[model samples]
Target: MLSEFKAFVMRGNVLDLAIAVIIGGAFATITKSLTDDVIMPVVGWLFGGFDFSSYFIRLGPIPESYAGSPTNYAALKEAGVPLFGYGEFITVTINFLILAFIIFLLVRYANKAMARFEKDEAPAADPADVVLLREIRDELKAQRGGQ
Candidate 1:
């Protein structure tokens, strides 16, 4: 059973998946930063300095201001208030779009690179071999004619 488990763990697909998961986690952080830090700020500036993260609808009695202006989502949820949270949704949607576009670009580049490599590595047909074979056939035809 231990050997079976070891074999399963050592398989190429499993290792590849593990590596992909780690890389995906890192990529998620990068996308999140791009959406929240870079893109959202620009978008907010365009909309007359409106921060999306703060644009939530308090379901119950609305507080004059949230305590310490809690930046984290969990804190807002814990405040015993149902919230719309559209700003966070917008940020998440932007991240997803950016990640999708990046993946599409990567796939396109990989396909182009594979095509170039295949073209370069293709075996060239020998013109000399073809000429030699034709000459042998012509010689055989001449001998048969003489006979």
Candidate 2:
């Protein structure tokens, strides 16, 4: 049973998947930073300093004990207030679009590079027997033409 388990863990697909998971986690962080630090600021500035992350509607009244700002989504949520956070949703949507586009570009570039690399490699030659047979057949045809 231990050997079976070891075999399962050592499989090529399993190792590939493990590496993919690690890389994907790292990629997620990069995309998150790109969305939060770079893209969001520019988008917000373009839309007259609109910040979608801050947009939310409190569905319930805030508790008297709650000291956080009423308009703050994170604070309201932490205070146990029910809220509709549409602005935050929009921000996430934009982030997803950006991440998807970046992945698409990477995949496109990789495919083009692979195609060019494949084109540069010469094709394999026919087997020796096949080549000899073809030569003999061509010679027979030539003899027939001369006859």
Candidate 3:
């Protein structure tokens, strides 16, 4: 059982999966930062400085002791107000779309590269037995010609 487990762990597919998971984690971090720091700002600017991150609708009354501004979604929520945070959802959806598109492009390019690598591969070396057989056949042909 242990040997079987070892064999499974040593498989090329298993190693490939492990590597892919590690790379995916790093990629997700990079995409998150790109969305939050770079893309979101540009999107906001394009929308005439309207911050989508703060867009929300109050579904419940604000608490009487709430000192924060009513328009502040975070503050209203912190004050125990039931709100529908649609702006944050939109931003998150945009981030997901960007990440998915990037991953798609990466996969497409990777497949192309793999295809190119396969096409450029050198032919396999002849087996020792085949080489010996060919040599013997050539020697027999040469002896027959000499006769």
Q: Against the true structure, whose TM-score is highest? A: 2
| TM-score of each candidate structure, all chains considered together | 0.76, 0.80, 0.70
lDDT tens digits, residues 1-147, model 3? 999999999999999999999998898889889988998899889988878879998998888888888899878877789999999898888878998999899889999999989988968899999999999999999999999
Candidate 2: tens digits of C-alpha lDDT, residues 91-142: 8888789878988999999999999999888697899999999999999999
Q: State the lDDT at 62 in candidate 1.
A: 35
Stretches of candidate 3 above 4 Å error? Answer: 1-19, 122-147
lDDT of 2 at 115: 94
Model 2 CA RMSD to the hidden true structure, in angstroms: 4.6
lDDT of 1: 0.83
Clash counts per candidate, in order, are 0, 0, 0
